[model samples]
Target: MEIDWIWGLLGGLLIGSGGAVYLLANGRIMGASGIIGGLVDGSGHATGGERLSFLAGVVTLPFLLTLMFGAVATHITGNLAVLVIAGLLVGIGTRLANGCTSGHGVCGISRLSLRGLVATCIYIAAGVFTVVLFRHLLGIV
Candidate 1:
């Protein structure tokens, strides 16, 4: 098999395992937005330590890995306004949906939640629509 597939499989397993662990340990869905939002808004005070540790691991693991291995190239938009607006929209959308993809797609769907199923469908549809609009119709990448 290709290295890409191996890495993808490893990454997916790690994500699923992490979500499972968080759910089992804390009885909370492992949503990035909810985790960070709780921390910033003081709503996660009951699990502040766990949340902080999770955030720390998330923030530092890649840097630690880079230090051990090498830096990975990333492509990001050069337009700050566009980046900011996109971030805001994502935040707003997640809030409206009550959970992010990780929460709805992985944990919620695993639990057989109708909301998760609907949200995941909506997210995928919106993503496809956005890609078509931006990349095909508007000639933007």
Candidate 2:
């Protein structure tokens, strides 16, 4: 396999392991949106300590890695308006769906929840369509 595939596999395994750990330890789904949303909305105040610690780890570990290694280069669109709109749309979608990809795709699907399965399918289809429409049809890529 290619190095990219190897890294992807490792990353996926780590993500799944983290999700499993969160569920087993805290009885919570390891969804980034849910975690952050709860904290933002003050709902996480009930389990403030755990939420805070988890967020801290999420924020700190990445910076620590970058400091130890090097910054992973990324390409983002120069359009700030597009970026802002995209973020807002994603936030709205997550709220409407009552969960994010991590919760639905990883934790929920693992437990054979129909909602998760359906949501994952729908989102995947939407993503594929979006990519095709933009990259192939409009040459946006």
Candidate 3:
């Protein structure tokens, strides 16, 4: 209904298509969270230079986009502690699960992997429960 919604959909489509293309062409899934986690852990799969470049791209792309488009980004006014904790939790979860949402939900699902299906279901359920718990039960948004 809104222009923002259309833009968001277009962005999602581009991301999904790019991810699929990357996977098909390179045989590597494009999962940002997993990539960052791997870089932090230094798991021997990705080199230091590669990891740093990936991190830089992830961090700087948004700024570059904003600079080019002159769009006002939404400010996330929240406690830094909460944000850090949430990021840590997500990092741990992805490590434990062996993949992040984009890896399992998009790449895995497209490949018809059973593990991906189950992981995606659990991911959605957990996300829903978290939202309900925080917004309704705890009265926090």
In the range 43-126, model 3's lDDT, one tens digit per residue, is 836555655665687679888988998877576648787688778888889888877878888778878989889999998999
Which 10-residue window in model 1 sums to the lowest lDDT?
A: 35-44
Candidate 1: tens digits of C-alpha lDDT, residues 36-85 = 87776787788889888988989899999999999887888787877898
Residue pairs that clash (backbone atoms under 3 angstroms), model 3: none
lDDT of candidate 1 vs native?
A: 0.87
lDDT string, candidate 2, 44-106, tens digits: 778878878888988898899999999887788777876887789888888778777898888
Name the candidate that leads on lDDT.
Answer: 1
User: What TM-score quantifies how close candidate 3 is to the native fold?
Assistant: 0.82
Full candidate order by lDDT, most accurate first: 1, 2, 3
RMSD in Å for all candidates: 1.7, 1.7, 2.3
> What's the lDDT of the predicted structure labeled candidate 3?
0.78
**Model 1 residue 80 lDDT score:** 86
